[model samples]
Target: MTAAEGQSGTTGAREDERPALLRMRAITKTFPGVRALENVDLDVRPGEIHAVCGENGAGKSTLMKVVSGVHPHGSYEGEMLFDGEPVAFRDIRASERRGVVIIHQELALVPYLSLAENIFLGNENSHRGVISWNETMRRAGELLRRVGLPDPPRTRVADIGVGRQQLVEIAKALSKHVRLLVLDEPTAALNDEDSRNLLELIKQLRDEGITCILISHKLNEIRRVADRVTVLRDGRTIETLTVRENPGDEPQLSEERIIRGMVGRDLDQRFPSRSRYEGADAGELALRVTGWTVRHPIDQQRRVVEDASLTVRRGEIVGLAGLMGAGRTELAMSLFGRSYGRYEAGSVHVSGEEVTTRTVTDAVSHGIAYVTEDRKTYGLNLIDSINRNVSLPSLSSLARRGVVDAHAERRVAERFRASMNIKAPTVAEHVGRLSGGNQQKVVLSKWIHADPQILILDEPTRGIDVGAKFEIYTVIDQLAARGKAVLFISSELPELLGMCDRIYTMAAGRVTGEIDRADATQESLMRRMTVDRS
Candidate 1:
């Protein structure tokens, strides 16, 4: 039987075939006001790369937490079978002891610690309660080589970039003797080259007989490496699909089919249909930056962004396209009044008039709003309520006699929540408890409340699902319809080609090419992106 018919909830394989390495039967989990998972079931064959794709708030993370013992036994009702043996794991350590390891979406490494020390953090290389430094370093080197990381064992985790830290995380998992690995959104923050390397590494591990369960919103990555795919929607298992082993024999799984299963309906277009910008360039300049240069804060001699120039007209959705470390984020932050890096030189103009913005407050007063790429770190206060977050930027307007109007604040928050379609029971819920898509919407809402004529959005839909992406696109179109100058920066070229009126390609801190909507093609953008700038 094919792998597709090899699950309990969806289908089953022939009795003569090998037993599944893991079976999660009738998994039901609940929170105070949410049925996160309801009677969900899954099966994983040994030595296969199984992918789980779902919209945000679809209980993908909850199911993985259950399997990894984050939501321990008795907290949720489920029967788990590992190697066809019934097991109830009391905690994460118990699961790890049985060769089941999970790497969360946010890495769990100590930044100040060295790579070797992080690899064997709690499971150390010790003799008589004394850690053997030599052994730890040797093993760390081997693990690093296994994960294709070239960093030395002595290098601090904080010193490396996000991509390298991810590899080090996998090395840490390897140290635990992982047989079944669960990776949640492994490549969400990665660029093209780094994502390719990580996917290749997952495939390599699968070939070595390690069962992998990958959760990702990127359908292209899922289609690239998944042997079988299981999709969850609204906290329910939709279907299990078998991927074509040989592309020459049969076409791989189509993204359309997966989207249908995920959203429970047909989505004719991945991107919303926007009007073309062939000859529609008559509006006044809404935002303009000229000869913008920023240097690395720690090393003032090293310039990160050099002589970059761009402009956005009124009601225009402009795209900034590049690979990782192309100084896209740095430029955006620097333009938002030196929020990042040391601003060396730049001229900013709003509505065709020069404006002086030296800080975040100054930028806001000058009708500029910047939604950061890392929402958790720089955007929202996770511990605060949603209403508070939404009301933050507009507090001055909502204030009366030096006192905030709580009733008006709540009303404004309610209006935005309804308009954005944020899925939460109440505005009083903490921002941290929400899903990736909802959190992104909240960030946008916060900025929109500021009422900026010019807006900068960096990776607006980075870790969100396709459905959420469509909704975000709709929101952007609405913003543009309201005559806002939107500067959209993303690593996904398809997004730029679909949503933007014009695109500017950045390579090595320089704006290499600019293409109109009609002229923008993935190949053209990529060619400009990889141009030799030395």
Candidate 2:
């Protein structure tokens, strides 16, 4: 954490002066078929931002639930000390009443309600069934400003974007007079600018002396703002490092060092090498999108993807670079046979033949595939087996006489598992048990196993760790080497610049400019992306 320089102590320091505001000692919890926590310990000072880092299924969320009273007291064998006293909470409300607030990764906000109503939903400022509207608005407005949200109290929750909703979560915590706030993957859905802004707000809150215990897969973000970082592996506390921003420090928080601690292995080779493209065979046209435009089906005036032209050919990876809401995903989804929005104008040609773009099935039949960003919601069925998700798009191929051939489905799943290097015990294993990166690979494997000529990857490595990202990159490059067209969209400029052969800069639903990979510097891309907005 860059807040200030403190007395140096290596693995998880505790001040000698006073008891921490919150402390969990030797926390042990077990669920069905898994020992989720094995004597894990954590502490949050009165005003410190203690970050928890780990791969998925690392028991980070389970420990937070233990702390925030979701697990209650007797169910878990642990001693939770808060405010120099042992407090056993039976429910979330029990914790909240005592100034503990937890904002989950999957946010809880009513879509139909206004910001003020959503802010004080269950705990309204009311008297005898009459809501005090003026007082509610005043307090909601204050909390919003504290969290740096630029929204009115009366604005409907569904009308605003996810970034603003994140700020609202922070505001909700603030409203609770929280002594300790737990945020789980708060910035996972935000763009670069919004992510930075949210981090700054977190710092500002820390300065105001509100303790924060945050869980994030983003190592760079943990390096940027965490006062202390606790690493968890296989449901245990591996090590907690007192993260300092000083360059002169012996253990600088570089990507290599972080990955080593997280995975307990040296990940020197991050991305696999790809073959250089030739003018004719390599960049030979596979998919061409010309004069493509789309509008919101209900809101006709809202043009989601405006007159955009792009081309991706065999063995060439064309990257789409833009900010969040710049229509990168919208454009990609719409072109996967117009599955995203109302196609007002456009023509899609696959290898000089006009391809259908009316429905998702038509797009799939026409040798086009799209991998949506959200795996839990759009990509995979969490409750189902991995075999099911991998065979979803091409189920008919594994069916015989309108009946699913279960053996054939298993074979297909096993084949893709080997090809994609998916780390699962069996094809029947639930996708919910896998890590973020593995789940992402499952999403990719599901699409690629369908044998698409042109692939559209939207934020392919959004929430995965470095190790998983490396694996996914290797698979993508291999696909390109075997002669497939790929349209890549990523918020990280460096990833796109490093991996893509060519790039398009988009802003406000339009492709503003194009750049070759050799010439696509981060500064150049940013300038192109933000030309007339200011």
Candidate 3:
């Protein structure tokens, strides 16, 4: 079929008046016992940003895999057309040959390699069998400039921050001459400033006539750059809504509308409402840290957390708010068994008793549980079963003479699975097979089973969808209601404002300010977060 013929058939009454650059019809993918996608249809026009929105298990990534050739042709039932021509890709390289490239949430770059080398690792600048270093550096420099990364091509990727690493991933994609760029949760790990810069770069790419497929849980970001959004629910395409007609046009999409299609229900509230706890009326202090100082583990001369002090009262959810590199995670990690850095000086008190938490075991024994921000890395063991992961922290309780009671462990896991609403057929299932939201629940269940009087949760709802976020919020509220002092740390200011009783802001390794819920606003928190008292 000719390009013009395909255009005439697909561009009927569309505002953009452009033919679909990519089209999929009757896509169906299935795992051993799971139907991941069922008759999922998607269309993308040239030079437009198309966003795919869905919950954690709604098959967003799976659909992208199908497009990117991660799931090779004939392994699934689908018909895909690129540039008005039927295409069947056998591997990622085959997709890349057609200028179709995908960047996953976890960046695929060699840490030890230089920027230029990483950018052209597989698609090297070479003549015959010899690699031309000069040509690679020259092209890498150009690509970096296009992505707004100021770092030199010779710089190692490991030396840079995550935001810069993301840019490098894009530069690598550019090296492949990517026409249809698929980004899965591109800004999930980025700070607000970095996220804005990345979004601006994406807009610039769209202007340069490069089509993009953005898979993100963040609704605001989708509304910002997407021309149209496709919502998938339970592995099926619910509807595709027009966000805007053109790049500079006013958006006609509401978050509520997109969310309704994703979850199949109207979510009246994003954050679950909790009972207010005022001063003096709040319960006794469950956790207190004073004069806490931590030096960087690698650089002993540098301080990551400096003289920080905070308190969390029983039944109260106190928020720790900060920008990236503001020492929020440093402080939490330092307090919890001094896990992160070298504790220079600090005093920890639990329920009016000064305690030493110099080790993880000591911290757990003292009734302090820390739920790490990186659930996949530090929180849960993905290879283990749900029951094993849930009972990990409290193994001693389920053990007799050092032999674990398997029946007791299963009972405990089952209780948490039911209470936390973990969507799994059995606790014997490996945690790796579960979605992001369910994996987070297992992490929480592990920590909660330890029966800690104080819980330090860091970025508990980072990458999950809005519906899953609401469920996580409900769980945190329940923990507080049970008189557990909660120290909630998050990058999102609105979340802290909604869920916290009091918020403490950090800047450059120091606590800058603290405010009550009634008095805190995004502006106030940001001001404190930017104002380094050093």
How many backbone clashes are present in model 2?
A: 1
- List, residue by residue over 23-106, the lDDT tens digit for candidate 3: 999999998678889999999989999999999889999999999999999988989999999999899999999999999876
RMSD (CA, Å), candidate 3 to true, equals 4.3
lDDT, residue 406, candidate 1: 93
Q: By lDDT, rank the candidates, best first.
A: 3, 1, 2
What C-alpha lDDT does candidate 3 achieve relative to the native structure? 0.88
Kindly provide the TM-score of model 3 when superposed on the true structure, using C-alpha atoms: 0.92
lDDT of 1 at 501: 94
Against the unseen true structure, what C-alpha lDDT does each candidate score? 0.88, 0.82, 0.88
| Top candidate when judged by TM-score against the true structure | 1
RMSD for each model, in Å, please?
2.8, 3.5, 4.3
Which pairs, if any, clash in model 3? none
**What value of lDDT does candidate 2 attain over all alpha carbons?**
0.82
Model 1 / residue 385 / CA error / Å: 1.1
- The residue ranges of model 1 lying beyond 4 angstroms of the native Cα positions read 1-9, 245-252, 275-282
**lDDT (10s digit) by residue, model 1, range 38-60:** 99999888888889988999999
Instruction: Give the Cα-based TM-score of candidate 1 against the true structure.
Output: 0.94
lDDT by residue (1-534, candidate 2, tens digit) is: 222222222333335454589888889998656688998877666787888877666788889989888898998887999998999999999999888899987668987899999999888999999999999999999988877777899998877766678778878777777878899988877877888988888877778888889888787888788877777877888776666543223434555555666788878776677776454676678999998899975578899788899899899899998886688878987887676778899899999898777988888888999998767777899888889999999898889999999999999899988887777778898988776767898999899889898999988987776766787898899889889899999888888987899999899888988999999899999988875642
